[model samples]
Target: MKTEEVLQHVTTPLVNPAFAPVVPRFTDREYLNIVYRTDEAALRAVVPEPLEIEEPLVRFEVMKMGDVSGYGPYTESGQAIPVTFDGERGEYLHAMYLDNFPATASGREVSAYPKTIGSPSLFADNGALVGTLDYGSQRVATATMGYKHHVLDLAEAAAQITVPTFMLKFVPGYDGAPRVAELVRTEITDVVVKQAWAGPARLQLFEHVLAPLADLPVREIVSASHILTDLTLAPVKPVHDYLKGVRS
Candidate 1:
């Protein structure tokens, strides 16, 4: 390819990209979010600088993508910590595990999402809504909630999902030095809340060497919600450049 063609390439492989260059839209994107308090020290350790913590709360979420625009159906599970950046409240995405390669690649490469390959699933088991994450053969996390016990306010559920999400984008150079290091932010703009509910819930995190979600132990289950919506993820924009004003 010519130099001009290379400059115009959006993603890797040049000839055939891993995923199409389109903002993903979801139809009936279901979410099982369990917000709980954790150790303050653990939150301090992982939550990067320039971001402040207020209550040491973490949201464990499992998302079931019913239909997507570019990538097909997939399930995802991850952890996000509530934090403040420049005095604004937002959630810092800690880790995300999904079962789809295109979604994973696009998330990490294009948007700098902390995504990796794992086995995560969400389904109704009898009367309970269950979400689980597994690494290889061992189960890492499991969350169960009473199905549709109480109707949740539409505005409340919409507020929770609309919060801005912060992520650390770190890419190393060929010589093992940092290439791209920045804090990026994004939020869902076109969200149509289809249904939402609240209920009693419980979560369990097991010890795993690779997916060490148990590092931030769950102290107390504060709240739980089951929400279904159709939304589109906005493109990410960098908020802070870590390498700025540095001497080489």
Candidate 2:
């Protein structure tokens, strides 16, 4: 069906209300990662002994994710957007939580991760050692190193927001430990949503809430997933409390 028709078909409830435009997002992640652990002996075997090994021991722990929360904008909007997480929904706000806009944030909070591959070689006596590897007499060490990314994927409550904004993070320092590395923001140049139904418990706020917005940077938007946590790394105070300050 046409987009307009689909929008038109949506119905409404009866109560026109005004609740806070904020909610809580709780994100718990069991992020599995690889950490590099090197030693003096190993360091001494990469390059010609006598070179300073800027970065030594290295390992890449493939990443895995575990989620366990159900934060959403339900309490505020009262419109169930329907977000399904972990193969199911209903008990949580997964079915109804849509998306967010950290990408549009000018501050652009960053996260880091780790590096994977490396190349090592042995140097000769009296051989000049350059580059980042450590070297000493009677020993070889590693040289230039980096990560060979497997792949990157994105998904949320229900349908994967195919175009959800994102960025890659790498481990900081020369160590390459998976910290909240470089962050990727979608750079939301503009946005527009049209809602057209509502009532009381019996109310619909589809249009009243989503319309009249255009070309807006996504960062300002505290989204449904804001209450979902990790997706939206909020400030120290809970998102709801922050909202209170905004509208107060």
**Tens digits of per-residue lDDT for model 2, 63-179:** 111331232211111111111222332111101111122211111222211111222121222322111111122111222112211222222322222122222333344555433
TM per candidate: 0.97, 0.16
Cα displacement (Å) at residue 153, model 1: 0.8
Model 2, global lDDT: 0.21
| Per-residue lDDT of model 1, residues 1-248, tens digit only | 78997998778787888888788889999999999999999899999999999998999999999799999999999999999999899999999999999899999988888999999999999999999999999999999999999999999999999999999998999999898899999998899998999999999999999999999999999999999999998989999999998828
Go through the candidates in order and give the C-alpha RMSD of each one to the true structure: 1.1, 25.7
Which residue ranges in model 2 land beyond 4 Å of their true spot?
Answer: 1-28, 38-248
Residue 24 in model 1: lDDT: 85
Once fitted onto the true fold, the runs of candidate 1 whose alpha carbons sit more than 4 angstroms away are none
The lowest-lDDT stretch of 10 consecutive residues in candidate 1 is 8-17
Name the top lDDT candidate: 1
lDDT of 2 at 214: 12
TM-score of 2: 0.16
